[model samples]
Every structure is written in structure tokens, then in C-alpha cells.
Target chain A: MAVLEVRGLEVRYPRASAPALRGIDLSLDRERLVVVGANGSGKTTLVRTVLGLVRPSAGWVRFDGRDVRTISGETGVSTNLAEVYRLISLPVRDLVEIVARLKGGDPAELEARLREFELGEVLGRRLFELSTGEQKIVGDLFAVSFGPRLVLLDEPFDNVDFSRRRRFVRLIRELRADLLLNTHELELIAQLDGWRLALMFEGRFLGPFAAADLDRLYLTRGTRADALAVMETSLGTFSVTRDSGDRPVKSATSLNALVESLA
Target chain B: MNLWRPYTKAMLANGSLWFWAFAFMAFWLAVGAFVESSGVGPGRSAVVAYTTSWYAVIVLLSLSMLAVAIANSLTYGSSALAYAFRFSRLTPEGYFGSIVGGSAVMGAALSFVLLGATAGMFGGRFRLLLLPADPAGLLAVSLLGGVFFMALAVTMILLVINYLGLKSTNFTGFLPLVLSITLGNAQIYLALPSWFVYGSPFNDLASLLYQGYAGTPATVELGAASVALTWEYLVVGILVWTAVLGASSLVLLRQIRSRQLEEGRQI
Candidate 1:
């Protein structure tokens, strides 16, 4: 059975002409589902609504074969405490232990995961003192370590490094929990293998697309002015660049020729 | 997850907690010394000047004022309460504990600190710890009373922090403290309504201390705290205030819990 299920979900903000979520239907089982969208495309609303932070105007959300509302409030950190929790004066060991215990998960298991990420030396130091990259790693660990049955992450890899993103992807892949990850970056979506990709725009889900289409989406903006082009995705235009007709240069990297030759 | 760990380890770990307690301790100590050397205040006797129930009233009032600042010492209110909610996430009883239990634990611990400091002051200026001037029986009653009042102080802090927050433009939180302190200072000749005078826990405590002793001379003889009111009366009055403050705290806490779930769910 699917661990989380949403059927015909509709969320209407008071006096808003358009619903935040319009008759959305989605489900989650034991797999990673990547949701990509433009800014304010209702990605967060869907996650927040399913997490029970936003009351839906219609339809229902079910988690673990029961109503999501019946389960509990949100499990992961919200944006308000995100910075505070990171900069909070507590040491890493205590924080990991506290979060693990609060989520009803195994602290020892989380410790083991942290060690796998080679975070043992940093555990004794305070979280605020850690570098931004290190903090992102800690955040990712905290989110998935508890092995929650269903996890909703909004922009999980936003501030993380490109080099570290793959490793973080591996870590998420190892999690027992099903994932509903929302992001604006197609790069993050492309890094994952065997993950379902969904599109959203203008407060609606445009539906899922094949992972094979990842490359074309990155063409949203061209490396140069003449290369830019657009293609239709579900409900919105996917911008791309035509690699073949770009001044017929050997590569786009050599703007050097134009600079030295002058206009 | 020991639900109490977060409240104590992180929320109470700040040095400001000690700063307030020690500052007040110094202020009260200075008062004790000044009155002894200068022979001022209502009572000529040093014991009356320092260890009287009137002083207890002052300490309670100070703690109330201090609770305002203490409540803001990072990792409190919505954040702390929300974390505590995790402990009882699936249970109704756990929910109540996280929201209300923080102050209960803190108030109980601080009561002992307050008692020790108040009693320790009887040791003179330099010494304020481990000195027992009051006999065991009377000291116990006084300490119990202190605990109830301290709990009330903590509740006031939580309510103000939850309601006024730091963003409030008005003095909603400070209104009561300002009135109580101002009215209480003028209480000597104010001739306010009887209920109003006694209604203030400060007044009742002062009256208890100001009145002459009825207890065995053994407890009063040590000269830290002297009680005029009967033991039964003191206990009943304190318990009544405890009940009153306890109920008030729960009411305020219900508001905090709802705020956490609804408006304060900032992400």
C-alpha cells in the first residue's frame, strides 16, 4: 500500500482568485519522488498541506494508511527554527540525540549514519560554529535519520554544494522513508536515478515527466544570447538553447574570440 | 526523550538565570547591611529588617519582574514548547506535560535556590549559602510558600513571552508588575480595600512576616525567619495562591499551545 496518498486536493486561500493547490492527486510509497517547479508554483503549499500545516479547502491527505492530520504536526524543521536550530548553542552530539529521541528513532543509528558521513570529529563542537556546508550536511542528516514513514522536504538541497549533492542523494536513497522533495533546480532533480519527476506552475501540478527529459529542461537559459529557445512542458514553456545553431562555433566557451577581435 | 532535558539543558543553560538571581541577592544583601548600619526601615531589629516576611514579599515581587527578562532568554516560548510537544506527539498527556511541565520543573528548582539565598542572607553579607537561621519546621513552611510564588513568577514570564512577545508596542506584560510594585510600595498608608491589600500575595506574605510569632521559640530563635500566622493558616493561604496561580498558568498555557499549532507555525 502507498504510505501517503492525496486525492483531488484543493487549497483556496481566502480571497485568492486561484487555489494554491488545484485538484491535485498524488501518492507516495517506498520511493523518491522529485518535484520541480518555478517560484511560487505551489510546491511548498502541497508539502505544507500534506504535513498538516495548511488546512485544505477540499479533498484529503492520507499517510501510512491513515489521515495525515490524524498522524501529527510536521516532523522536519520549519524555516523559522532552521537558522536558530543551526546556530543554537548546543553541540552536535546533543542535538542529534535530541532530534533522534524526539522523532522516536534510534540515536545510535543516527550516530552511525553521521559517522558514515565522516562527521565524528565535528560532533563535539557546537552547531553554530560549523561552516555553512557542514551545517547543510547536519540538516540533511537530521531530516532523514529518524526513518519517518513519510518525509516531506522543501528545497532539501538548496544551499548545499554541488560536489556534496551526490553524496547527500546517496544518503537519501539509503533512507527507509518515502520522500516528497520539492526543488526549483533541475540540476538537483537530474542527479537522482530512478526517481519520479513532477512539474508545477501557477498553483497547479502540471503532472509528472520522464527522467530522460532532464537535459532539455536545463536549456531554460542559453549560455549565449543567440542560443536561447523555448519548448512546451506540461502547463508552462520550458526554455532551452539550440546547441546546433549557436553561431556555428566549435564551443560556447570561447567568448575570447569576440573579445580580442572587438565589435 | 526525557521531556525535561530540553527545557533544562538548553533553555536554562544561559548565564542570565544566575545573573538575575545573584543581582537580586546582592541588592537584598546591600539592603540588609545598609539597614543594619544605618538603622532605617520599619523595624529597628536586624532580624526584622532582613529576615522578616516583608523581605520575602520583596523577593517574590523581584522574581516576578525578573521572570519577564528570563522568559526571553533564547530557546523559550513557541520554540521550546513546540519541541516539548514532540515528547507527547501521539499522546494527550504528553502534550500537557511539554507545554506546562517546563515552568513546573524550573519553578521547583528555583524555589530551593530562592530559599537558600533568602536563608543564607541571615549569615550576614559575605555568606549566603548553606546557612540555616530558621528552624526546620518554620523554614519548611516558608520554603513551600516560596515555591508556590516562584511557580507563579514563572507562569507570568511564560504568559508575557507568549502573548506580548518582543514585538509588542504596548506594555501589556509590564502593566501588572508596574501596578503591583507601585501600589505595594505605598501600601503602608494607602488604606486600599482590604481585599486589594491582601489580594496581593506580597501583602499577605508581608503581614505574615510582620505579625509576631506564634510558633515554638526554637524555630524563631535561630533568627532567620519569624512567623506570626499559625502554621495552618500560612499553609492554606499559600496553597490557595498556588491553586490560583496554577490555574492561571494553565489558562495561559492553553493560549500558548494553540498559538504554537496555529499562528506561530512559521516556516
Candidate 2:
């Protein structure tokens, strides 16, 4: 069975005229799924919906075969404490201890996991004191700890240094579970193997393309500037540029295009 | 050791818990000193002690106010409660345990501290009882009465917290706690104010404490059923409040958990 499945999910903010996500359908068993879109293209919203942080105005979220609602039954952490659990910036120790208790992990095993993350010493410190890279490590560690068959990572690389980003890419390789991550960091795409890419525009999730297709998607823009412009307007924007040798480089035309492609 | 590990960890992990415990102890110490110093002499000390006990009453009243605010905040997501949700993994039961346990431990610690201070002030031969304080006798009655009041106070706070929701944070969760404290304090002077007393546990506690404090001789005049001062009363009262707060917190936690799940799924 697919470890995680989402179908026709839609999210609308309280007063917004437009929906955040209109009809997002996706599935994964154990492979890594990277969502690339522009800002506000619904990447984060999609992840949030899957994580059960946002309620869907429409559609269903399923982990394994169970509905997301059933996973959070009568006996569990309430919404009040949910925000606390989402605090990735907390010290590695505190986060692991909390996740250990939440997932009902054996204390010894939790300790082992902490050591594995090279965070045994760091755990004793406050979460806010950790470096940005350390904080991301803690976040990834927690997401991987509970054997969550399907994990949603929203903008996992935001504010992370390139070196740490590479480290996180290595960590992602070591992760033995399925992942659905949202980010615009293309560097990650170059490093991680066996991951599918989902392009997003406005509120739509475009192709779940292969790496070669993504390379072509990057290349074809130069050959078809008019098509790129049309796609950019619908998708948001497109820009053409050149290298030191004056080679035509077709890229994002505006911030909107960049955010949409990243989202 | 592992069994006590959670308690020790709790005490150490959250300095505020220890702070509340010690703060209560200091409060009781002050009350004891005030009572001893105000003595007009000999047998009439009872009257003086009675009046001076009002200091302790104020402390208890403040605690009630705090309880009310805490309950409301817990139910409503007031400041401290909101912080608790953010920093602590406290399930409803955990939250309740922390508050009630901290309160009682502080209350009892303060009681003893006050007693010691009072003895020191008198400078006479003070009878130090090595035996456990009577939990089932007169002291039990007093403590039980206290617990009844505390429970009612806690419930009132919880109800407000639950109903107030996000608005509970406006006053940093102090509003509900203060409101409870004020209302509970007002009850002391109102001679069983019609609204709070008829069906409330505090009514029973008020009569119980009066009887317990007054002793065996006054017991008959105070009521039909007489219970002696025993150590069990303190133990039992502590246990009862612990249980009550715990149960209520659990219920609240479940509600919060479900809401978060809906949120996560929405994510």
C-alpha cells in the first residue's frame, strides 16, 4: 500500500478570495517526493494539509490506509500542544525527548537516536541556542524518529547554508522512509537520487516529472521563449539571460516566477 | 529511582514548579510568624491566631485567584497556558498534575515552614511532632475542606478557559485566574453567597474547616457528623485534588490534540 496518499485536497484561508490549494492529488510509498513551486504556489499548504496542521476545505488525506482524522483519535496531543511539537528550533535533546514520549519510543532507543544525530550534548541546551544547521538536523531527526511512513517537510532548506544543505541532503539519503518536501532549493535536486519533482503554478500541481524531464524543463524554455512567456504568465513570469560567453539563458522573469517555480 | 525520575525531572526541568512549591512554603512561614508575633498572650492566642490566619487566607485566596486564572487559561489558552502549550508537551493530565501537584506541595511546604517559623518566634518549648501530621483527623477535615474549595476553584477556572478560547490570552491568562481568585475570595465574606454555595463543594469545605480548626469540643456544636484530625486527611486531600485536576486536564488535552490533528491534516 502507498505509505501516504492525498487526493483532491483544497485549502482556503479565512478571508481570502482564492484557495491556497485547489486540487492536489499525490501518492508515495517510500520514495522521496520534492515539490517545487513559486511562493504561495500551495507547496507549504499542501505539506501543511498532509501533516494535519491545516484543515482541508475539500478532499482526503490518508497515511497508509487510515484517514488522517483517525490517526489523531480521542487519546493524544491536542491542537494546543501541536504548535509546541512543531518547534524545530528547540534544542535537539528537548525535541527528541518530546518526540520519544509522543511516539511512545523506548527511552534507550530515543537516546540512541539522539546520539546518531550527533546531538547528545546539544540536547541538554535550549533549542533556540542551536545553529540554523543544527536546528534543521533536529527537525529532520524528529521527522525520521517516529517511523512516520510518510513525512511532510515544508521548505526544509530555508535559511540553511550550502554546506549544511549538503549535509541535510546526505541525511535525507540515510532516511529509510518516504518524504514529501517543499522547497525551491534546486541544489538538493542535483544531490539526492530517486526523488520525483512536482512543479506547481498558482494553485495547481503540474507534472510529477523525472530528473531528466526536469533538466529538459529547464532547457526547453530557451528554445520556446514565447511558450515560456505564456507559461510564465499562467505560471507567473519568465526571463531570458546569458552566460559570460553570451549563451542565451532562459530563467524566471520576476520574483513571482521564482516563487511559483520554487513553490 | 526510575519511578521517581519523572517527578525529579519535572521538578528540575521546570523551575517554576519548584518556585511555586517554595513560594507557598514561604507564604505559610510568614503567616506563622505573623500569628506568633501578634499574640496578646496565653489562651487568648486562639483568637489572635484565628484573626492572623487571615494572612494565610489571603495567600489561599491569591492561590484561588491564580487557580481560576490558570483554569480559564487552560480552557481558554491564556498567556501562561499558551506558553505551556508551546514549550511543554503537557497533555491535559500532565498539565493538571503539574499545577495541582505544584500547588499542594507548595501549600504543605508553606504550612510546615510557617509552623517552624512560628515556633522560633515563640522561643518557648515547642512540641515538634515527628509523627506524620494527622491526615484523617481534624487536620484531614481542614485539608479536605481546602481541597473542596480548590477543586471548585479549579473547575471554575477550567470552564472559563474552555469557553474563552483564544480571547483568554488577552490578559496573559491572568484574567480567569484572577477572576476565580476574586470570586472565591468574595465567597469567604458572603457567608455562603447564594450563587456559589448551594451546590458547590466550597460550601461543605467552609463548614468542614471551621469544625476542624475549632477542635473536638466545638465539633458537636458545628455539625452532626464528627471526624477527628488525622494525617490521612492531608494525604487524601492532596491525592483527591491531584486526581481531579488530572482528570480535567486529560479531557482538555484530548480536545486540543484533535484540533491539532485537524490542523496538521490541513497542512
Clashing pairs in 1: A219-A240, A220-A239
The global Cα lDDT (0 to 1) of model 1 is 0.53
Error of 1 at A211 (Å): 3.6
Residue runs of model 2 more than 4 Å from their true location after superposition: A73-95, A106-118, A218-255, A258-263, B1-8, B11-13, B17-165, B170-172, B175-190, B193-198, B201-251, B257-267
lDDT (Cα atoms) of all candidates against the true structure: 0.53, 0.48
lDDT of 1 by residue, A1-263 (tens): 77778999999976887788888889777776878665667887887677555679899987656675555444542221243243135688887676666666778886887788777877898876787667767766766665566566777676677656778787777766777888776655555777776666556564455544554432332234543433333333433333342232122222223112221
DockQ score for model 2, please? Answer: 0.20
Worst 10 residues of 2 chain B by lDDT: B258-267
* Candidate 2 CAPRI category: incorrect
- In DockQ terms, which candidate is top? 2
Q: Provide per-model DockQ scores.
A: 0.14, 0.20
Instruction: Give the fraction of native contacts in model 1.
Output: 0.07
Give the Cα error of residue A42 in candidate 2, in Å: 3.2
